[model samples]
Target: MTTSTKQRPEPMSVRRRTPAWAKAVIALVAVLAVLFAGLRLSVLPGLRDLFGMDTHDRSGPVLLRSIQDMSRYEAASGTFQVVVDLERDSKYLPSAIRGTRTLYVGAGTVDAYVDLGRVGRQDVTVDADRTSATLRLPHAALGKPTLDPDRSYAVSKQRGLLDRIGDLFSDNPNSERAVQKLAVRHIGEAAKESELTARAETNTTAMLDGLLKSLGFKEVKVSYGT
Candidate 1:
C-alpha cells in the first residue's frame, strides 16, 4: 500500500494593493504634518509671505480739497491727555436695567499761533536813524484741539440689560461719539488752563529779536496787543 498522503496545499500568501487615492491621501497628510511642524518651529521664514499675511492698505486716493494759505506762525504746541467717564441712565429705570457707561482715554494737541497776516505797515515803527524798530503784534491765540485717534482709546464700557439688548438691533451700536466729545471738551479745557500761549509769546519774541538783530536793528521792541 504505497500510501502517498495528499500534501496539504501551501497557503497562498495574499498581498493587498493600496488604492491610488489612499496613497495620495497618505502623501498629503505627511506633507501637512511637515508644514505644521515647520510653522510651529518657525523654521520657514517665507511661509508668511507665501500666504500673503502682510497688511495691505486698500484705501482710495486722497482727493485734493480747497487749500488755504496759512499765515499764522505756529510758535508752540501742547499735548494734552484726559480721561472721560461718561454714563447715561434712564430716569424711570434702575441703573442695572437701563444705563450705559464708558471710560475713555483721549490724547490731543493744541497749537498756539501768532497771526502774522494781521501785521500792518502802521504796526511797524522805524526810528529816524532806521536802526531802532518797534513791532505791535497780536497775542498768541489757541487753535482747535486736534484729537489724535492713534493715542485715544476707550478703556472700558458697561451697558445695562436694555442697552445691551438694543445694541444687537442697532447699527453702529458701539459708537463712541458721546465719550469722544466729552474727551475733546476736557482736553480743550486742559489746554486752555496750560501755559501754551505764554510759551508761544516767548518763542515769538525770541524769533523776532533774532530776525531784527540780523536786519541791522540795534533796538527791537515787540509789544503785543489783545
Candidate 2:
C-alpha cells in the first residue's frame, strides 16, 4: 500500500497593486476634483460679474446696490442713460415678476435714464463736474407725494420721495419710443451684463428715497401713463 503523502499546496502569492485602469481613473477623478474646487473657491469670487456677486437668493441686496451704483455714476458726471425696463419675462407668465433692467448709459456718463414701471420713467443729466443734475419727466406719469420744487425745496411731502424724480423738465420723457426706438440707442450703451441690469430695474426705487431730502423732484403722480 503506497501511503500517499499529501503534498501541502504551495502558498499562493498575490500581487497587491491596484489595476492600471483603476489607477488612471483615480488620477483623472482627482485632477477634476481639484479643478472644480479651485473654480468654486478661488476663481469665481472676484470675477467682476456684471450682475454683482452670485446670490443664492434672487431677491437680495444685489439689486439695490446695482441701482445705487448707477446713481453714483450719474452724480459723478458720467453721461449715460440707464434704461430700467420692467419687461415681462416671456417664460415667466401669469405673474408680474419684475425682471432685469436694461441700462442704457450715455457717453461721458453724465446722464442716466431708466424706466421703473410703477414709479414711472426718468431721464437724468448731471454736469461733467457733478455739480448740477437735471431730470426730465412727463407731467402725465407723476405720482402722489412727489417732490415740489414749485412748492418748496424744503418739501414737507418730499419725505421718502427720491425714487421717481430724476426726470426733470416737461420734455419728451420717452422720446426714444416714437422714432422707432427708445432713447437707449442714443445713450452710452445698453447694459448687457447682469450687474447693470439690476441697477436699471431698481434705480427708481432707490433714488426716490434719497431725493425727498434734497427737493429733487417737482411732482410725482401715480397711475398716470405718459
By TM-score, who's the top model here? Answer: 1
Backbone clash pairs for candidate 1 read none
Error of 1 at 175 (Å): 1.1
Root-mean-square deviation of each candidate, in angstroms? 13.8, 22.9
Stretches of candidate 1 off by over 4 Å are: 1-58
- Residue by residue across 41-105, what tens digits does model 2's lDDT show? 33556544544565575674545434332212221122233333323233543222222223332
Show model 2 residue runs off by greater than 4 Å: 1-7, 16-19, 38-137, 140-226
Best of the candidates, lDDT: 1
Cα error, residue 109 of model 1, in Å, equals: 1.1
Clashes of each: 0, 35
Distance from true location, Cα of 127 in model 1, Å: 1.9
Rate residue 108 of model 1 by lDDT: 91
Model 1 vs truth, CA RMSD: 13.8
